[model samples]
Target: MVEFTDWDIFRNLALAARWTVLLSIIAFIGGGVVAGILLLLRMTKNVLLVGLVRVYTEVFQGTPLLMQLFLAFFGLSLLGIDIGAWTAASLAMTLFTSAYLCEIWRGCIDSLPKGQWEASRTLGLNYFQTMRYVIVPQSVRVATAPTMGFSVQVVKNTALASIIGFVELTKAGTMLNNATFEPFKVFSLVALFYFAICYPLTRYSKYLERKLNVAG
Candidate 1:
């Protein structure tokens, strides 16, 4: 049996933590682009498009992330796409993250006073101009805190990527546990690494919320 010292466990988990960070970046950026598009679509006064956005958001938010990852990993392979765990995990998380993000942004946009839009319209501002100049600026102020809060959730959800054989922090911990038979030691660091990543985000998000509220 191979022996794992405390340092060894720490060192290994730390190495794996890098992948976790990288994946989180990928998901956040990719999800942002997608959510932006979806938000714009929802804003449009089209019944069919609005319904479609609603359905997309509900389907993703209603389902478990694990199942999404599984489908992305296995389902793609079935179609002979030959995607790896990394690609699959990223795809699933991006979609999942985008759904929530769209909701957050839409809620932010909607939170603006109806008068703001009406005023913009009276000023002869078109839809895009109204959003760009008036509505969006105010909405962003409201959305900042919530978006930061949601980013923490995205980071935590990266742990789910492990189930699909991605070598992120959780997967690394599991592998180390099996090899060393040290579940407590292994998973403790796993949790700590996650906490290390998430705690600051949590604190900062709260800070932003307070700061934004005060300014507004």
Candidate 2:
């Protein structure tokens, strides 16, 4: 068996963690864009469009993300569309993230007083104008804390990408453990790395919740 010093493992894992962070950022941003479009469509009050958005959200949110990753990685091959592990993982993560964020943002928008809509209408603002000038601005504050909290989930979820052969922190740990036969030490460090990345976001999420007085 090849020997791996603790420092060697740490160094390799830290390098791999950069990919984890990058994947999470890409997925989260892509998801936000998709979620924003869905939110706007739902806001249009078109029954068909709203129902479609609801079904999309339910389909993604109700299913296991692991299954989604598998499908993204394997299913496309059946249709003759080739994709690498990174592409598949990014696609799956973006779709999964979009579903939950859409709901979170929708709930925030709905929580606002109905009178704001009425008042905006009285001022002769159309649906788009009212949303842009009034609803969206107010809802942003309510959404910020929860959005940050969801970002932590996005980061943790990147580990699932390892199942498809993405060389992320978890995958690196697994590779190192296999090489050195040190699952305990390797995985403990892996968990510590994840905690190091996630804990600050978790704490900051709580801080925002408290500061915004939006805590449940």
TM-score of 2: 0.96
Q: Give lDDT tens digits, candidate 2, residues 84-179.
A: 999999999999999999999999999999999999999999988998899998899899999999999999999999999999999999999889
Q: Residues 58-147, candidate 1, lDDT per residue (tens digit)?
A: 999999999999999999999999999999989999999999999999988877779998998899999889988998888888988888
The estimated TM-scores of all candidates read 0.96, 0.96
In the predicted model 2, the residue pairs found to clash are none
Q: Least lDDT summed over 10 consecutive residues: which range in candidate 1?
A: 207-216
Badly placed stretches (over 4 Å) of model 1 are 214-216
